[model samples]
Target: MARMLEISKLTIRNFFCLREFEISFQNRGLVLISGPNGSGKSSIYEAILWCLFNRTARQSRVDDVVNDIVKKDCQVIIDGYLNGKPLKVSRFRKHSVAGNDLVVVYDGENFKGSPSEIQLQLEKLVRADFNQFLLISSFIPERIRTFAAATPAQRLAILGGILDLHHFDMAYEYTRSRLKQYQVELASLEKEISVIERNLEGIKADIDYLERNKAKKKEEAEEEKHQLVLEKRRLIYRIKQVQKELERFQKGKAVDYEAEERKLKEERNELSSKLTQINGKLHSLRQQYHDLQQIEAKDYIGKPCPVCERPISKNLVHRLMQDHKRKMSVVSRQIKTAEEEKEEIENRINELQKRIEYLATEKLSQEKARIQYENELSNLRDKLSFVQNKIDSIEKDISTYDNLLKKRYKDLKKNRKEIDKLIEKQNELNHKIELYEIIKEMFGKKGIRFEYIRQVLQKLEEETQKILYVLSSSKLDLEIEVNNKEEIEIKVYRTGIKKRYEDCSSGEKHRIECALAFGLNRMARSFHLMSTNFLFLDELFDRALDVEGQEKVFEILQQMEREIETVFVVSHRPELQSQFSNVVVMRG
Candidate 1:
């Protein structure tokens, strides 16, 4: 059997709409917290919510809770007893940051750890957060008004919260994420193994080629190098013979190729110097012409000519203009003539360069016989180097192929073992994937997600209908069930056909809301979520309710007291003040 919690006292200071407020709730039957509209009735429950959950029923920001009149630190103090043992929960703002606030909890008169730690203990004791507490212990009439207006997902989420099966949705999402991660890892491993297999294939081909040719290749290379050495010795003898004859011939047949090249270079340099001087003179004359033209264009009227520094009259301006134009024409012709000469000089220099190159080529032609003999000598040396390299390479291959193939075969064997292990792991992961797919189907569809939930819900439907029948004692029976799409549907079954919650009248909807709210409270109390006791109604009787609907709500309240320890009904109405046995009046 579970123990019931009894809250004895609550104190608030500078919380929203509450400044220096305190109230006590005894462990008994219905206790009404009655007041007018602005009498801080809602703040009473909000303070209790803040004490237990570190938040308010409205989910207001931390900064919004500090009463505008107080301008001071906010606090909520709740002292209670759990199964006759003393317990206290207090929360107060210490600094601006929301998480920086402090929460202290006491068990049997001893204070515990930090805010977060104390919150964990408090949650264990209460078994409900702020929203869950409201759903189970509190009545909010806006739910009936807004049910048809909420989106399908939002409606489903609301039903899920009441059903207390939202954790299954979170679990499904987590499992799917893990399955995706495993698949990614398997793909990466497969890619890595493929690269290893390719390397193994290349290594095997090299090993086979070296193994088939090693001994025979070594013998053939040694014989070939011996023959190459004999030919090299004969070529060396011939090279010395050719050099002796060539040196004797060069001593008598000399040509001065450098002196002729130097004369051609001197002629090219003189032409280049003349061309540079002409370009410089042409540039200077062109700039003077431009200066005079700018001076003439600006109307030069009663202004001094910029170039001559003389006072300008009409006649003087005309003369300056004609002079400038004549000078400009002369400079342009000079520039064109200079450009022509520069081209001629460039061509002459190119011709001289070609002539010098021709002389060099002629000298090279004269030494062709010597070059031919040297080339023959170089060819013999290269052939010797090639043969020697062939002999060395074959020896190295014989030694290295044995060591390399041994190492490669060892690596190949190791890779095969690793591949076997990966295959085993892959098989296990495949089995896991199959299980996860089934889980996805169960969690995603109505197959098992609703199957396990249906048992609890079917019993709940009977319980709700029983409570509704006891309240009205009429032929109308309520049905609450999840459809094939896993959506929660609420209906009334009075006639042969069924009617949805949306089609019901305002009063009938109010009655349904009462039944569902009481049933939820019933669920929470039975499951030890709402202290196994009383219910709290926040302005439910003040809504647009007819006399019959109000009577039905009172009946639900009567049921609350009989089923639990104590109940609270928060209302602003004056006529219903005498209905409750215990009442605590609130002041604005």
Candidate 2:
């Protein structure tokens, strides 16, 4: 059941070369839109395209669609009915301002949405995209061969959108993506498993090596510890012996050599002082004796008085002489006594020096002995510390052997468990990889999508042949084939003689193009399950068609008029205008 799209009216203002054109498409049948060059015949349908989709086939830019004379304010309005509901589309651009100013009134209610949103709603209302309208519903002379001439990828993309096969593409991409992810995960797990296996092998070797050497290592540790103990005992005994020696050297009564030397020095100084005093007294006594001898040798009695420079009496002189002799005798006795005292003081000082020298020698010998004993004791203490450290290290080594083996066994068990888990995870990832690989193949372009294209081509071939039969004078048949390469091949057969599209004559190509357009329209109507009442043909019968060829094309349109509500055909031949009752002529 195909719903009908009945376009009632189209209004155009300042669009392209139209410049305020209006036409009523309601209740029309096989109408002729005859016009000379640049008379706005194509602009009429261009305006309708712009109103519905914000697009025109003639222009790339929206501003270019505005009429050159008017220079601004391009508007196109289309009033139509979709499934018996009123649908109105209005598109306006006042000098390209307000950004795609578009509105759609559907079922007598204004639909609120952006231009693109409303466009989507309109497309859904018609059950087709703009490409579908341009390719199937509207037949333009310049674009009639678009589907047949498109590259393989371009054709697939266009066909894919019209057929609504985006889900198949999505499924293919998603499955391939999941497959790749699973493969990467599986690779990582394989690498992890490899590392775990290597680690397990290493652990097994380590456990075996440890088991083989455990008893021997323990025996060696014990033997080493016993030797260290013996060495420690020997060091302790030597340290004790050195300590005794140090104590023995330290216990002697220490003599105060400095005090003894000080006392002896003081006594020697006192004796020397006494001797110096005795020598001084003897020297004075000698001087007095010499003076008395000199006085006796000289006759001072007859000389002037030595003290006063006056003549002196003999009796006075003789008394003075006697006094001098007595003084001399006293000085001689004093000199003898002083000499004896000086000799005694000298002997006492010599004894004190000898005693001080003896004390210094004894002090030096005792200091040397004390330093030797202290050095030996220090050396013994250092050796004892070293031996004690060795003993402690050996004991620690002996204690750790059992614990070391136990830890190795524990690590081996832990690594084995980890390897098992990794293997299990690796298995799980492998299963996922297999599943996704199958899923990827199922959704690929050569899989289910291939079948879909095959079915479409089959239906397309049938429809094209039916229309191509009426358009071709040589009983031409159209065959659209989808090969394994996913390439579409459109072939024309004339009584079983096949020919490529490009090999056809110009007039033949045009007829083929016309039939292909109608065939696609029929296919689209079937696919959408909707009847699109409007069909536009721009200069389909104007060129490359002789009189009989032209009549054949017109006959197809007349047959379509029975089913379609409006069929507007643009032509330059004035003779064909007489064949249609409803005709709109554009004179430029």
Candidate 3:
């Protein structure tokens, strides 16, 4: 019923006047925070505000937030719930620096960002800001007159903020910002679309041009390829012919001219040697014939007597002559035979010389013809290789053209797909721009936000009157008026007599402000859909309200225990402690 906000725990260290403090507010109600001056009674609630919004009731800077005596960094940790979800916040401020740090965990997630951003996130979850907390959920003596003392326009604005109407302003601005972003994106997409269109046109022209040249180049390559193929065939034929001619030249038994000449020269030398031996033998035989004719057996008989010193007989001489004649006849026949054999050998040697000369001439002519045929064959093969290389080059050119055509087609297809995607993105951006425009109008001040304020203004007036009556023991009634311009003026009535807020006594004014704050807190929870559950009255009982007035205020706040889980009453009065079921005491 109280929007489910609960501060279950608060821990403070070296913050403000308190050196170290911790308390649990779980299941607490109507708590009395009693302490002497500078005992940090108000600091308890200030710590909560500082943890939630990085602001305090006192007009102090960040450097002064740390305890003066401790001279240490200030830290505040708060564990709570927002809309029934767990919330934890830790705030820190260094004594020597002007920077304040914040960390938040909401619904089991650590809120991420800078200190300022985390503060905004916490404010968003609680549906309240520092001003709203001061005006609605808290009644600090220092800020008590802020709302009532403001001008009509300022008061209207302040009430609107307490009712959580600034969220509409943020939404309107965010929507307008989104709309501008979409418009810019759409413009950029249109430019992309235009560039893509031009590219597509260029691509089409390129494809057309390639297509025209493609056939012409292919035809030229085919013709050249055909001519090369024919040339290669002609070279092949010529090579085959030359090879056949070369084979014919090689088809002879290899001649060894040196061996033939050696054999002929050896045969001639042998025959000449035989002729000389025959001539020598013939001369010896002739010499023997001449000696036999010149000297008969008489000389041989005398020479034998001289050699042997023996007598020669007439009969022995006659017999020796007959033997010499027989020897001479055999020698003459051997001479004739040697002369005929020498003539035959000389004729064979002359025939061998003529054969060797003919062999030398034939070998020379054959070698020249073989060399000519080999040279012709080598030339034909080189021509054939050159023609084959030309054919291969032409084929490669044809393949290159085909690959180029394929790549061009791929480019054309890719460009077309890119154009389609751009068109789709353009449509999506246009629709988003249209939707954001409608949202912008809806979140404007005079739109749904205006209607909500109108209805809440009535409920706020009624609730304030109710609370004021209870707080004043039916002696005080409150009326809230709103002009056409949304300016507010609070009117108070005492027993049916109208009294101006400025004219009321201090006690009456405090009661009226308290009533108004309570009404706004209730309206914020119920009508504005904000989550809240705590109310802080810092020295509200000690300032101007008498004992009876304090009792009335306490009684009404006690009644609020059913809705608000925690209500902190900061006071130094000892008599007030007996009235509360829960008492938290702080000492300086």
Candidate 2, residues 287-330: lDDT per residue as tens digits?
A: 87787777752586667887887877778778887887788778
Lowest lDDT sum, 10 consecutive residues, model 3, at: 249-258
Residue lDDT tens for model 3, 52-76: 8777878578778889987777899
Q: Rate the local accuracy (lDDT) of all candidates.
A: 0.70, 0.77, 0.78
User: RMSD, each candidate, Å?
Assistant: 31.9, 9.9, 8.5
Model 2 worst lDDT run, 10 consecutive residues: 246-255
Per-residue lDDT tens digits of candidate 1, residues 73-120? 788777777767777766776434443455554564444677787777
Over the full model, what C-alpha lDDT does candidate 2 score relative to the true structure?
0.77
How far residue 365's Cα lies from its native spot in candidate 1, in Å, is: 55
Residue pairs clashing in model 2 are none
What's model 1's lDDT at 223? Answer: 79
Clash count, predicted structure 2: 0
Error at 580, model 1, angstroms: 3.0
List candidate 3 segments past 4 Å from native: 1-56, 60-132, 140-145, 148-203, 255-354, 422-516, 527-588
TM-score of each: 0.59, 0.56, 0.60
What is the number of backbone collisions in each predicted candidate, taken in the order shown? 0, 0, 0
